[model samples]
Target: MANSTAKKNILNKIKQALDTPVPLPFELNNEAVNVFQPAKEELEIIFAEAFTKLQGKFIFCADENELHAQLQLLISSKEWMKIFCNEDQWNVLYSNTLNLESCDAAITGCEYLVARTGTIVMSAAQQSGRTVSVYAPIHICIAFTNQLVYDIKDALQFFKEKYIAIPSLITFASGPSRTADIEKTLVTGVHGPKEVYLFLVDKTA
Candidate 1:
């Protein structure tokens, strides 16, 4: 009887605490970050390092020929019957002869590559809509060296300057989807693509 009474008292105390409202401990600041300024080479190195840590595959292509060669080799080695790509990049995948619906993988380009966080910034304007990017089993992103930005702020600034109106959808894809909600057991591809590959092309070459 005494223990039951103590339990009731604890429940009542918790209810009283919940009923009371408390102000936040600290004020929120809206100031943007402006300290870091990374060079092109430094950005590439940092992006590669951070992306690798997230289990993303990174490949560098020195020129168009190398890019085609690497892509062809990957397709052949994987024995993929068909490869999907955005219509805008049809010239890049001259050898690809399959339709998007029948493809096992999708290749698309991104708006900007964030070096600080190792994220690829994408928008709905791109041919490969949200469906193709996340639905496919394999995702391959083609990005140029010039697209690399020091951080998210720089990327956002680029968007602000380039687009008159913001896109309906924007994606900051850091890596493949991973879930650890159930029993804390890590599972990849739970909500999105199983694998992601980044082809960093040297447009200058």
Candidate 2:
């Protein structure tokens, strides 16, 4: 009888507490806050600096002709016999006849470039898909100036506005893959590409 009474008292107290809900301890502010100082430099310059610092190669092309010339030069210099490019548009753009199985490097297009973090945003929606970026030893991204955004929040907003439903997979790559898992020693490219290259083409210029 005493146990039953105690249980009833606890249930009644819970019900009373639920009925008279307590207010939040502090008032809530819904306004967005800027935590970091405003970036003074141009987005391209900032992105280049940050990307290079993270061991990513950055290239700027004024036009398609310049981009082709630069790509040809790089390919010749590196002597990468088979460059993997599956996208039909990219293949036609660069005049590449790619074979995936024997390619030395992979070239792909990105969704957006985050200038603040020097990150490349990619999605499975693109023809390149997920594997094309990480499967190869060297991953090269071809992006345009207009695709650049200042902050990650801006990128997320862009994604939300661009698509009715988000892609199945969205990835942000900052540079070549690196980890310090074994013996706390820093290692690069254990899980992904050893080298990452970003070719930023200036569509405005």
Candidate 3:
């Protein structure tokens, strides 16, 4: 009888402990506010580090001359006889010398560069569209430093603020398409571009 009473007491104590109210780890609104606010320099550093770790190339150019030089060097190194680019972007960034069909690579402009996850946000309306960025062997994106945002949420908010009408689709490309299907061995470029490069121009300069 005594042992039965002790067991009941123990059970009640545990129940009471569990029922006690504990403080939340953090206030939800404050935490979200903190996450949404990020310094520009901090975003730049984190994005570069994360993107590099993903095997994506990050190129920073101070001015238009340097940007052109980098692009020329990359084109020569890849031996890209012809390049595919959106007509609008080509008009703004290049002379119309390369045809669309014969191009070995496709370069486009991105809507936003996400810092936290090292992602580039692309809209269907952009020059690259959906097919060129994914179908081409190499995908090169040009973005101004002003386009960098702290996180995906911030990127979305930026788009909302900037555009009254959103595009039909938005793609967040983090790195080259990769799969580890057989024996857990990873292979890249199976579904999409084999290489991804981001040319970030410092607009402040």
lDDT of each: 0.81, 0.89, 0.82
Model 2 per-residue lDDT tens digits across residues 71-159: 88998899887788877768765535456645788999999999999999999989998898998888989999999998888888999
Which candidate leads in lDDT? 2
Clashes in each model (backbone N, CA, C under 3 Å)? 0, 0, 0
TM-scores vs. true structure, each candidate: 0.78, 0.87, 0.77
Mark the 10 consecutive residues where model 1 has the least summed lDDT: 89-98
> lDDT per residue, candidate 3, 35-119, as tens digits?
4446557777889988988889999999777988999899888887667776484545653335554567788888999898899
Q: What lDDT does candidate 1 reach at residue 18?
A: 87
| Model 1 CA deviation exceeding 4 Å by range | 1-41, 91-102
lDDT of 1 by residue, 122-158 (tens): 9987877777778778888889999998888888888
After best superposition, candidate 1 residue 67: deviation in angstroms? 0.6
- RMSD (Å) of each candidate, 1 decimal: 6.7, 2.4, 6.7
C-alpha-based local distance difference test score of model 3: 0.82
Name the 10 consecutive residues with the lowest summed lDDT in model 2.
Answer: 93-102
Please state the error at residue 9 of candidate 2 in Å.
5.4
